[model samples]
Target: MLAMNYRGPYRVRAETMPDPVIEHPNDAIVKVLRSCICGSDLHLYHGLVPDTRVGTTFGHEFVGEVIEVGSTVQNLKLGDRVIVPFNVFCGTCYFCQRELYGNCHNTNPQATAVGGIYGYSHTAGGYAGGQAQFVRVPFADVGPTKIPDELLLEDAVMLTDAFPTGYQAAEMGDIREGDTVVVFGAGPVGIFAAKSAWLMGAGRVIVVDHVEYRLEFVRGFAQCETVDFKSVKDMALHIKKMTDWLGADVCIDCVGCEAAGSALQHLTGVKLKLQGGSATALHWAINSVRKGGNVSIVGVYGPTFNAVPIGNAVNKGLTLRMNQASVKRHLPRLIEHIQAGRIEPHRVISHVMPLEEVADAYHLFSSKLDGCIKTVLIPPGVTA
Candidate 1:
């Protein structure tokens, strides 16, 4: 099988690797039909996430056909096309019972935080992702949902991670009807967050980003206002001004560790490895929301400490909520939304490249070239 092989920071290429086989009783081998390059994958690509070993594949959003299944894998069988959630979890655990699949205790039990994630890194249970011709799916019965016949494979793939994460970001905000919500970052996740805010009855949705193309894309896609943070002197102040000086009712940080804009933050966190990725977006979120409003975070950050504004948050009495999206928990409702045409997840896709050219796809996406918003990789023989 050909897989995206991670060599080092800024280095990845398609290389022939051994085909995956069922390793556990609940495991299944999937022939990947469609996979994606998520914004979160960039963290591993840039070596910001810890313990991302060389030779590991990096992809979490994918939909595939079950080629084989183990003895205990009763939910899936050969020829079943499924959307595999990014979370690799045991459905019966305490956290999973509460519908917090991202924090499942049985998977990645060694860690005190985050559960198993496909192709993230050793810190995320060292599971191989689906950025290849095939992938091994553990706890197959719990995580892989059959793709609805009415759903496009491209749309179903986004539900595996980005769409769910974005939707979860909005849900965590607890947006009241007519509340003004400002989303920081215009990536796929941010765009979805902005879109979800509207579905939840937000009166106003604004996306903040330094990239003009992304701003333009989100503005058109989500039908919301956009802010180019690079054009503003103080992001927080600008957001406050936009909200009539009281600040937005809700602020979301969709930009994580790699956020640009702060020289000191980049120098200390990204360059010096002194703290977990830059907290620039987080800083903007904490200071840009109304005093008693909510701040929702769906961005990926390192496990280490960040230079966050705890004092400001405490002083303002903000409700800060964050966690990896429990993709399994959001699947059913999201599927209904997609089937009903409430959201078109595939519209976010800007490029579709063959899996063999994954190296080029990574470069194009990470560099933000060719007006790329989302790139989906199709395996060699599979036509999607």
Candidate 2:
């Protein structure tokens, strides 16, 4: 099997690796038909996430056909087309029983925070991802959902991570009808969050980003306003002005550790490794929401401490909610949204490349080249 190999920072290649076999009674082997290079994958590509081993593959969003299943995997079988959630978990655990699949206690029990994440890093259970011809899915019964026959492979793949994540971000915001919601970042997650805000009855939705193409794309896709943060002198102040000086009713931080706009944050967090990725977007979120408003975070950040505006949040009485998207929990409702044409997840895909060019795909997405919003990688023999 050919898989994306992580060599070092800013380096990756397609290399032949041993095919995965069922290792646990609940395990299954999947022949990947479609895989995605998520925005969070750039953290590993840029050597930000801790303990990302050199030989590990990096991908979490994927849809595949089950080729084999273990003895205990009764929910799935050979020839089943499924979309595997990014989380690997045992469904009977305390957290899983409560529908908090991302924090399942049985998987990655060594960590105090975050559960098993496919292809993230050692900190995320060290599970191999689906950025290859095949992948091993653990706790298969609880995670993989059968893809609806009417759903496109592209949209089905997004359900594995991006769509659910974005929806969760907005869901956490607790947006009230007629409230003004502001989203930070215009990546696929942010775009989805902005769109979800509308579905949640938000009167106004504004997406913020430094990239013109992304800002333009989200404005159309989400049917909301956009702000190019690079053009503003002070992001928080600009957002306040947009909201009539009282600030937005809700603010979302979709941009995590790698956020720009702060020289000090970039220098100390990103370049010096002094803190978990930059907190620029978080700072804006804390400072730009109205008093007593909500701040929802779906952005991926390191486990280490970040220089955030905790004081401002406390003083303003803001409700700050954040967590990895419980992809399994949101799957059923999101499937309905997709099937009804309420949201077109595949429209976010700007590029589709062959899995053989995984290296180039990484560079293109990380560099934000070619107006790339989302890139889906198709395995060598698979057709998009």
Candidate 3:
């Protein structure tokens, strides 16, 4: 099997690797058909996340066909086409029972903070991801869902992470009727969050990013206003002015640790590694929302602390909510939205390449070249 091998920071390649086999009674072996390079994957590519061991695969958003299943895996079988969520969790644990799948206690060694994440790093449980020909799926019954007959493979792969994550960001906003919502970052998750805000009764939606292509894309996709923060002298003040000086009702920080804005934040967060990741977006979210409003965060960040505006948040009485999306918990509604043509997930896809070209795929996405919004990796046996 050929898998994406992590050599070091800013380096990944397609290398020959042993095929995965069922290792546990609940484990299943999936032959990956369609997999995506998520925005969060950039953290691993840039070596931002801790404990990302070399030679480990890095992918969590994938859909595949089941080739083998262990004795205890009853929910799935050979030949089943499924979309596996990014989370690797046991369904019966306390957090899982409460639908907090991302914090499942039974799957990860570092279970105090985050549960096992496929291909993330050792800190999230050193489970290999699906950026290859085959992947081992633990607790298969609880995570993999059969792709709906009406859904496209492109959309199914996105549902594994981007869509559910974006939707969860909106859900956390607690948006009220006629509220104004502003989402920072115009990546796929931000795009979906902006669109989902409309579904949740937000009267207005605004997406912020410095990339002109992304801003233009989200404006059409989410039917929302756009803000190029690079053009504004004071981004928070701009948002306040857009919201009639009170500030937005809900502000979402979809840009996590790798966020680029001020030179100071970039130097301290990215270059110095003093903070977990850049907290620029978080700073804006905390300072730009109306008093007593909500701030929803779905951006991926490391476990370490980053410089944040706690004093401003406390003074404004903001409700801050954040967590990894429980993908399974939101699939049904998202599937309905996709089937009904309300949200077209595949429209965001800008690049698709073979699995063997994983190296180039990473470069394209990481560099943000070719107007690349999303990239999908198709295995050898899979058709485009």
| Prediction RMSDs, each to the true structure | 0.8, 0.8, 0.8
Tens digits of lDDT, candidate 3, 191-259: 999999999999999999999999999999999999888888888899999988999999998999999
Candidate 1 residue pairs in clash (backbone atoms < 3 Å) = none
- Candidate 1 lDDT over residue span 112-182, tens digit each: 87999999999999999999999999998888999988889989999999999999999999999999999
**CA shift at 67, candidate 3, in angstroms?**
0.8
Taking all chains together, each candidate's TM-score versus the true structure is: 0.99, 0.99, 0.99
lDDT of each: 0.93, 0.92, 0.92
Worst 10 residues of 2 by lDDT: 261-270
Model 1 — which ten-residue stretch has the worst lDDT?
261-270
Cα-based lDDT at residue 187, candidate 3: 96
TM-score between candidate 1 and the true structure? 0.99
Q: How far does residue 213 in candidate 2 sit from its true spot (Å)?
A: 0.8
Q: After superposition, how far is residue 308 of candidate 3 from its true place, in Å?
A: 0.8
Which pairs of residues have clashing backbones in candidate 3? Answer: 257-278
lDDT of 3 at 200: 97
